[model samples]
Target chain A: MKLKGVQQTNWIGVGIFVLIVLIFPFVVTQSFLLNHATFTGIYVIVSLGLGLLMGYAGQISLGQAAFYGVGAYATAIMTTTYGLSPWIGLIFSIAIAALLAYIMGYTMARLSGYYLAMATLAFGIIVHSVLVEWRSVTLGASGFYGIPSINIFGYTITQGIPYYYFVWAFAIIGIIICLNIVHSRVGRALRSIHDSEIASSAMGVETGKYKTQIFVLSAIFAGVAGWLFAHMSYSISPSSFTLDASIIFLAMVVLGGSSSVWGAVLGTVLITMIQVTVHTLGEQFTFITSEFEHVVYGLILVLVIIFMPRGLFPTISSWLNNKMSQRSSETQEKKAS
Target chain B: MLEVKNVTKTFGGVVANKDVSFSFEEGQIVGLIGPNGAGKSTMFNMISAIFPPSEGEIIFRKQRIDKMPTNAMAPLGISRTFQNLQVFKNMTVVENVMVGRHIRTKTGTLRAALKLPGTKKEEVSAYDKAMEYIQFVGLQDLYDHLAGNLALGKLRLLELARALATEPKLLLLDEIAAGLNHKETKEMSNLIEKIRNNGTTVFVVEHDMDLVMSICDKIIVLDQGEKIAEGTPREIQSNQRVITAYLGAEVEKNAQ
Candidate 1:
């Protein structure tokens, strides 16, 4: 069956991916590239959750970066302003983001398609405004600073390589959790909802309940990424959590293939590399504008939508499968001869 | 075990079903046949809780379920296929059936994502159970095939298998024989008989008179959004009003 062959190839791909992840830090010793890789790991965690929502559940949210910001600001305020432990701040950050998602999703989950997109877009704008306008709590646009690094067992992971491994550890765990959800009953129900909400409800799937739950779960993932990012950068800023970041996260999920978690990781890495390339190119070519990144993102989004709507991973995998099957059949014909 | 108490459904200015009532005991293959726009599908939808009746109640095993949501009906042992074929097109045959086991299993989203011991164990059993229904509907060979790739006949059977996966006490089949060739229609009728013999109270809405006549233990006929007749197949065939409904008053009089 095609199932077994596809699964075997997937395991092999995972093996190769693991090897690359382990060797990436050592081979790329430059802090500039390593910095991008570290950020890619953090974004992978967030995009994995978005993949479940948009890819599997067929729901869209344009406000994920708001949750990310909420997590960073929550932890920043908790640890720096209130003198709470970083662990406590981490929990608060995750809880606060999840709570906000639950409250918004309670009413917003009923909307579908472009309406839902517009609703979440408004939500992103509101959250971004709060980050800028709420001067007393968010420190306005000057940004919050001096946040303590995460300490585990009295060891601080301050170095670039150490934190890179740390960030990837959480991203790996996030991937495992997302894959579990994708394969389990909940995952199937979400996909069924994606395919046909009427049929899904007829099959006894509580669509509204599942939609809200996945929204909360996605927010939880974004919160974790934000917490890691806050500690990694040691600073929180409103500019980092703008609508553009949300669009980038969306682009990553779309480019990686929305339905697959591994695709999200691949998308995150590809998009991060593209960003670094754009930045480097902009510096080298003074003619290139600072706004070139958005232009490139827009072009990629439009091209991917037109050419590979299912995303890169599924398209490439299916093409590979077709080639292998053709070769196998030719071999069988030769044997018959 | 199911009762439709004077169910009446209206859409704006049009009354689709007017004061229609019917009830059936468990383990009987009951058929609902009607001409087009005769409210057969509307009655089925109301019983499946797709929409609440305008001025009536639906009772399943003595509990009022008219006000309940559609998804809640499955847990209460009422599952239905659709007239337009509501198969999950993107899912595989087995995955589509497995989703029908949603009410049967109780693993929440968090526990599933965590992949706890209980979730894994429940998944295995759910898979086995879903396979049982898939094989019951003769789709075991194509279990891995995506539903979108299946033909119209196979899609109908896939919908049946999915409904069976819910393990319902009452199964509602909406035009299960539609768009099938002669041989495929015969097989569908046989499958319906087997489903009824297996102890599911089958409630089918069909336009295929031959399939209904051969398989249904009792038949209910609707015309102009009202119950025109209800009896055994033999009784329904000779009933004057039923004949008139299907063949017009002149044909009924001429037959007499």
Candidate 2:
């Protein structure tokens, strides 16, 4: 009974997700929905990493898409050119991304706020340019094509349903790992550093080391997601993993609330759904164009930043709890009268 | 025991401390009295390993600690409170103290992540220690309050509690009695004495002459980055150079 409340809520969330994932193929029966779900799962993985970095650690990283791209490009090159297994490439992607993250984090951890953001933004742009200009490796503007689908135990997951299960498996693992990290000692240190780096360091926390570790860990998560993305789509493009994509990932983290891992999943799912729906609507109504989606996104970001800076989950959860408490109070008052 | 040998620190061309050498025996409350810009805080910072001294050695229980980083120094049983009050504002009062105990925590990041049996036990112990420290600082009632929301006096107490939670062998208190009423200063002086009685050597940098004179077993005076005098409080009160440099001729004449 002590854990009954938490268990009930968790079960409710898990049940809804299970129903949706199971019934979605039957209801839609379209390749578009399957694609959207795959993309949504990828975003979920990346957003979870971003959430841990920005929300918990209080480090705004604009270079996560760069790491994501790094994973994709690394896997693409290894698999296509060297004929390496995608699984091996996935491990290497994490290593390379983690190494890059360590260097960047060490340099940028000392910088604060806008300066830190600018540093990461510059890094993202540099990576994007490298992807565009590196002809032999990334295939430049022609893009890397014919990435082999993920193969597990000699079974090629070439279809949407199989790929959906793969993406969901990794997404769930990523979420669980992030949640565990959030409640750990490192998590406490990250929160303290976010509040005041000086105070944290003075309290005998190796502030710089912890920040760098989190940065690298988050990058590894992003890299894993990128690996999944490349394998799922069976294609890679420089355009998809641009600075704009990085911004979209950040928006997902902020919109869903950076404070909780569940927020990351909710945010990714919500944003992906909106994007798919908007694209469909744009096809029907010529006036509702793809360009307008950015405007809508910008407006939503502004509203969230202004009204609910703690993010959607904390805000919504508190409101619901408050209403429940009020209703209970009213019932008690009536019984007493 | 704590010893600083020929500690010299310079910020670019400006010399902050020059050949500052002193020793504090265990169980003694030593007062470092200095005028503004007297390198009192600079010395404290160096001793606490916030920054390495330009040329010198810091020996704590005969172990050189000058090369150690601030974080590592805590586990070496050295702790300090900032002059500006470096309490973690976003954390609760108890959590602020828990940060001090972080070095002693046996739980690894992985164990903490998994919420394993070892980590859970450590967590319970840490909470208990934090509560004990809160009570030690007479902040039991406000243990749940955010440190930033507390009053200035309470914040000072919180900083003291946090530092104490490190279970330090040597405590460096920078301007602990700087902004307090007469009664509060007296209480703080008593608290410093209590801290000393608990087997922790204390080095306090304070401007309140009355509190310093009453609490300190020995007094070291600095003026413009140099040690002007070092002796008993009565001897320091009578020293002509200390009078001229700090209290002035008028105060010396009044004392006579």
Candidate 3:
């Protein structure tokens, strides 16, 4: 309610993103590149949710990838073993994630700062351990395979251009939904929670309740990404849902600017691109090591922490927005002269 | 009307407020005057429901509010400004006031996410309401300025505007004139009177005797966690106990 939304011009960024999402698959013909791009969309969805939690609500979650794994497993088990529809699996994935988060959200959110981070990290470790130990249902460490490709209205979309278009559609929708929340009363409440929890309570905002709500929502986002990942990859493993993956998602949020939605997507794309790029160049840097991808990512993460600690997306985007406004004013002056 | 009955608040062995009992009728600018660590803020905190009193009952509008949560007070027609400045550092001036209207606002997260018609309508009205308070406190020029960027005096005015936006029946202001210049204090005194005249009961705690004596219809004095005197401005000015409490027996020595 009484929340007056952030009145910044957000539509311009939204417009550019919609255009790019529509034309991106058509222009990019290489299947290898297209595959990585598709994965980027999935990461974008998760990171945007993380950005909302980390940036606005001022809640840190290190178990987001655990939810992602849950979504993937839900899809992998429901469709392959239970013989259910892929759509149902996707929905179940989100539901399961939300239910798990709802149970622990309030207790964990009430513990601020380092306690919150450690709580989430412990949750991630537990989830990952379950995925490894529970062999009967999840296939354990051996992983689940032969997941059916997603199908819509008699069109079986496989591992090429169609899959790219399909997954990016969800990313585009996720971005728009995120933007809507960011500029509305929800965003104001979240930002207020971050600003001062005491003042927010004084203003009638139940800080704990709002924190729990956002935590559940962010978990669902990661779950949705996990669902898409299972169907697209046709297999699943516990390693993808580990604490390291969660840290990378956090890195994505920080590098892109946690408060900015587009920043989340940009950060995901940048990190994913670097991973793909460096994997190829590992042979070239033979003197250094075979695990060059880790070296490159670690370096970038450190640089981001040091030089652009506030986040690159928010800083750069605000600067660009200012420049645009200034040029427009200059143009008006020129016309007057 | 508001009643604080035998309220005693203690943290461990230290009693911050001890057996403090006082009440203010509707539409009165009541001042709670005390020296530092004299339990004025402790009283305000108890009445505002920041924490439950260790021993006492607080009645607001005939309902016992001693057990209510801090957030539950605003909706029960009670609001307060903090002794320490508590403006949302991330929000604009108007946005801070809008947050004060949180209790009255009824939109759900889903409706806000979808940009439904009711949410849109409420948002516009909330903006208008926030702006009205911003102008009331004479911060229309800095309506869009980030609250963290404002001066201490301006922030105090912003807090007043925010509390007023809640439209509380009983408003507790803890040191509303603290850190303000003479002119600013004068304006604040006038605003407090205006707020009282508008039908909201005003409860203020302050060390500024000049401002307190000029505006307060009734005054209560606290010394070392105990209420020493309660009367009108003239009675409080002449009370032997009040003088002895403030001047600490030095006045009684002169009188002897």
Candidate 4:
């Protein structure tokens, strides 16, 4: 009982995606490449959550990295200090993030545009400050170390190859769940609210309730992604999850299509690849400084906003679909006439 | 039936609706007409539960509904089209209508997440109903068009279709004829009558005196948040207070 035309295509795409991800590790043996792919997967999961909140739900959040940091810190603290299992820490992290998100969302949901953005920005900054100032527990600016590797059912994912599979598996699961939510009634309600809050309310969509639910759900996803990252990296610093990281996450949402799930994945992969490549080039080329990379990134962001406001995925997909449909309609009309 | 009793709404110190009382019976087309600042739209807002009246009570289907949120009022079979055409601009015409059907849906979020049988069936039915309303409003040709791209007249039609898609027992229309051409206004008035004929009461706030005079079963005139006259359209047309409040005392004297 799926939506007839698009549903079949989506399932086919998912199948091909599963196949590609499953075979990816075999093709790439380099540790750096594997590590990059794992990081991409983690970002993809978090970005997909952000995309759902911003793109479909019409919310602007600059606090995603805060939730991500919360998850990572919670998992790290739970595993190291409490001597708990990483898996248990993962669950606890998601719960804590969701609880915090629920409280924040209740207050933040009523705000729109610049106000909402500012509130979330403040939240990310606050989280980053806490991580730095709380020295005894968090180890402050030096960052936390000795985070134990994740063990799933007696399988220790300590190295690149095993960890790559683990992160990607979680990413694929995250993508599937996000896809389901996007196509569901909840997604429709969100889109409605995004378009016109008053109209959606008049239609009996409890706007506040739905907003909070999506916010909390997105936080949980970010938390889970953080847990994966913390365990895989075996180290995390407050600097890694700052307001700048939150902006990067938001950039991924905008660079991909905000409303599309695959856009989140594509955006994460492209941005990470670009960052890694540019950093590598900076080491070789004397002129290619960190400042130059920042300039380039800023320029690209401006260009995307001006020309492809819907993001790369939506623009490409719509263009391709438009051409295909045009050909089909022409053929059908020719036959009819 | 919908009843508004001694409803008073004040925005800060300014009174928008003061001691206004009215009731609409089932299967009736009631025209709420007033000049500028007569509080017609404010009274409509109060009836639709957009904001609670500062004083007094609103009863719909024999239930006190003034305290309910606007979102919660849709399930009780009350729906409204906004004065400025509040169609979901990002959505297609059909999707805008489908949102109206959301209240009737029995699917829980978890069930929707899992794509359960209940949600699947409900989704299909909701789409079908949306299509029906789109056709009812004569917008079937533009069913898949994004509401934002539609012309002003079409957007109004889309808003009406969306409100109708809720399967409402009573529909409130605020300035539905405000921007329409003469022909479009006539068509709108006829369509509203047809909707009323289909066992739904219609309460419309209109500035078009011609449409109100021709189509309304009963007319309620307000002046500065006070009910000046309530009767058949002919009675309202001849009412001295309504003429004085609407057309000025000089115009009323000339008419007499």
On DockQ, the leading prediction is: 1
Score candidate 4 by lDDT.
0.86
Model 3 per-residue lDDT tens digits across residues A154-214: 9999887788888888888788777777766667777777887766777777777777887
Index of the highest-lDDT prediction: 1
CA deviation > 4 Å runs, candidate 1: A1-12, B250-256
**What TM-score would each prediction reach against the true structure?**
0.96, 0.86, 0.94, 0.93
Q: lDDT tens string, model 2, A118-230?
A: 77788899999998998877889778889988788999987687887788778876766676566555666677777766657666788777767777888888899889888
Model 2 has an lDDT value of 0.81
Residue A333's lDDT in candidate 3: 98
lDDT of 4 by residue, B51-132 (tens): 8899999999889999998898789889999997788887788878878888877665556656666766777788888888
**What would the per-residue lDDT of candidate 1 be over residues B137-244, giving only the tens digit for each residue?**
898889888789999999999999999999999999999888999999999999989998888999999988999999999999999899999999999998888878
TM-score of 2: 0.86
Question: Which of the two, 1 or 3, has more TM-score?
Answer: 1
- Residue pairs with clashing backbones, model 3: none
Q: How far out, in Å, is residue A164 in model 4?
A: 1.9
Give per-residue CA lDDT, model 3, range B172-195, as digits (tens).
899989899999999999899889
Interface RMSD of 1: 2.5
> What ranking of all candidate models by TM-score puts the best one first?
1, 3, 4, 2
User: Model 4 chain B, poorest ten-residue lDDT window?
Assistant: B106-115
RMSD of each: 2.0, 4.0, 2.6, 2.6
Candidate 2: chain B TM-score equals: 0.95
lDDT of 4 by residue, A87-115 (tens): 89988889999999988888876665666
